[model samples]
Target: MAMPFFNNMLALLGAIGFWPSVVYFPVEMTIARLNIKKRSLKWLGLESLNFICFLLTLASASAAVRQITQALGQYKPFMYKA
Candidate 1:
């Protein structure tokens, strides 16, 4: 029972981690397929900046959740006091 729950959780995290890159790939491919050229550097730069921001945000949020869980674990004994 516990193993299945753990596996499901891991799978969920994997999907969340995988989606942004998966989404970016097809859109980039489609852009290339369209044969559009002579794009502005400003637009490309901004897109790259946005992608970096997204990855950082996800990473920070995951870190914060982990930290909160760790803190709760520390406080568990105190909660059981009579």
Candidate 2:
């Protein structure tokens, strides 16, 4: 159903290399003429930073989701006293 498709898209977006691939576009274009080694190094550094940012964002989002879910799940039975 639509839920599964949406979940799959999220998972794909959250994959480790996804953001780097998106962020690397400008770097790739700029360095298209560089020697192989230099280009590789530049890409490696850019990708590393991109990935780190992506991971931090993902972690924060996950923590927020967890907190929201925990708060939603909290309940007291004292009203019923059973």
Report the lDDT of model 2 for residue 45: 85
Clashing pairs in 1: none
TM-score of 1: 0.44
The positional error of residue 34 in candidate 1, measured at the CA in angstroms, is 23
Q: What is the C-alpha RMSD of each candidate to the true structure, in Å?
A: 6.3, 8.2
Reference-based lDDT, each prediction: 0.56, 0.55
User: Residues 17-81, candidate 2, lDDT per residue (tens digit)?
Assistant: 44456555655565565643654777688657756767775775565556545544653433342
Per-model TM against the reference: 0.44, 0.44
Q: What is the C-alpha lDDT profile of model 1 across 1-82, one tens digit per residue?
A: 2232344346446646663666566556655676545356644754575577567657755765675565555553324434
